[model samples]
Target: MAYDIKDVRTAMDPVDNQYHIVLIIILISLIIAAGISVLFTGGQGPGETLNLSGSLVEQDSTGQKEDPAETWIVRILWVDDQNRTYSFQDYPQDTKPDPKSYTFTGDPPPGAQAAMIRFLSWDGSTERTQGARYIMDPDSVTAVLNRYTLMARLSPLPTTTPVTTNTPAPSGTPIPGMLIPESGVVCRNADGSCTARFGYTSRHDHPVSLPVSDMNRFYPGEPDRGQPVVFMPGIHHDVFSVTYPGDATNLVWFLMDKQVSVGTVPRVNTSIMIEPISGYAPLEVRFSERSTGSVPNNPLAGTWNLGDGTITSITGPFYHRYEYPGRYTVSYTVSNACSQARDSGVVTVYQASYTWDTDPKNPATVRFSCTSTGDPSVWFWDFGDGYTSWEQNPVHTYQRAGTYQVGLTISGQHGKGSVVHTISVPS
Candidate 1:
């Protein structure tokens, strides 16, 4: 029998052919397995597992322990770089006379930057108290768990405290001392009005009830504008508020021998007022001297420390421009003869800018770079091609040659800002 050359070769190489076929089959199987794995895992691969453990104790300012029957609920919250929050909760065993210990095991989501641990104490079916929040970086989470462990001594809720009454002095020997008035805060309202809050410190051991009269009154308006008649012992903050027109001046409060003023002319007090305190850089801020209290022979003299390495002796309304993005503290101090007063304000400035370069060989492909200020932590890119990216600097390719609008937005600790640009791509 005569055999063809192909048949002769095939018969001699049957084992080799079989080996090649098996290898091809193995490669196909691996490809299919990889595809399935990606489909199930979303191509992100395995995540990092985190183990957290901590202890919590409930106590008040006086070091009084909480009830043994009370239980604490621990909440673990984490924020990713994109500002998304994820949470997990756990319960602590009510081991009285000792701090409650808790353990949490889970996978930390991708891009997690920070975490917070909050404790809520419960009594039966009702939550009794919410404790302090502990904040830490994600990188330090495991270290904190291993080294420090979660430990917090929280103050009990005010509502749960027992009320105690103080004994009054016998027959009232004039109550010993009087109340001191203080000007607290002057807040600007949105309707072009201003609200001035005032407080007082009572030196007496018992509550002093003083009717609204010339002894305790406000000037340049009604004597009694909801002023508190019954003064509680100890220091009280924002006890009463007086509203006035934005342009109103010389609002004063008198409590016996003590007096405080707001917007007084020939200003007896020192205060600084700033306009446009926060904005995008180059920010222009207006500074006005709200302190006009000058004596007959001693006039107020002051200097400004603008925080940006600049100091000036100019004593009138002035304007300063900040070229960089940052938080700047501006302070003014005035002193003459008897007293000195200082006032300070903070200015927050932010900036957002970017630059782009095109691929010389492929004009349709472009690379972007962010040159923003203020320490941006989050970035968003809009390519105007129906696709968006969260990357700080993203390279994109246009399908066809045309003009496209691109926008970049960034936000961080200081502030947020955005910019847009138009670009042309060549075919």
Candidate 2:
């Protein structure tokens, strides 16, 4: 057949070819199916699933008993790196159902960083309602899911497109002796459901109360002391339903996953007292503890630093003698786990004793001098007459004295000392 090339090409056109049309339709359908699959997978590449599990608790019994129809609406909230939020709602098993445990599985959307499970309970008959929120740790969720088989052929589905969340509440400031929970979690199913385990807080480290108290004590007491508890890192979760007054349902859930760290220990509390701190060379001083902490069997050690280049570890009362006359700074330090405490005082040793010399011309006129070896800041002298002098040396005239009592008192940084002597004047 001698046919025109234009006619032959037109005869083979796709619109005219049934097989070509069928193939084209199949290609278009495949593209649509792929796009649908991505949406259902929450845009995850593949094989990544988030597993979460917890229990549902009834915080309010009064309202549930009054209106059997009082139902709970549970939802999960997911936040992305951009702070975009999405929610997935979960329907109750039935109109009215008993509280029980639940598990959630899904693939998280790309750029998802944080997720929270919110429990909101309301009396369908009235306007009264209450809610509680638990923040989840993604690493914790993964660890828990690793223990179980992921849901077969299941992917995260977004219920709502990305939207701006409320101005996020400020994160709680970290406190001393307290651990701060992880932040920024993303979820797969918007508000449907999410699961997480507290991996960082697992039983390995020592755990303490959130707001520590002096009255709080370690668990498993007596036998447990010294023997550390073995905590396996995995999903640890618990749900609590606390009955709050009024229609409000207050619920708080937590997993004791972390060990408590030691924070500022109790400060060392005590004082030091020294008696006869200063005296002539060969001065002996008595040192003792004035007080210490009220805690029993305290872990504190006591030591003394004698200003004269001597340090000693002593228990109970301590006595030390200074061989040379000099001024020394004495300090005592009480060492304990919490802190080190110290107290300081000065000690002075005198060089010479009290002495007086009579004038060559007049014996009645006597020159009184403090030959004491130590250095005294202040000196006082009483000639036994009605006279007093604040001088290291003073000359006194005895009017008609057969015998007179002379007294000298010295005061220094270390302590105070006094001496008395009898003087005779020729009549």
User: Quick one: best TM-score, which candidate?
Assistant: 1
In model 2, what lDDT does residue 373 have?
48
lDDT of 1 by residue, 300-363 (tens): 7888999999999997898999998889999999875335679999998877889999999899
lDDT of 1: 0.66
lDDT of 2 by residue, 188-222 (tens): 12333222112223321122333322222122222
lDDT of each: 0.66, 0.51
- The segments of candidate 2 whose C-alpha lies over 4 angstroms from its true place after superposition are 1-266, 294-298, 353-370, 373-427
Give the root-mean-square deviation of each candidate in angstroms. 40.1, 22.3
Of candidate 2, the 10-residue stretch with the lowest lDDT total is: 239-248
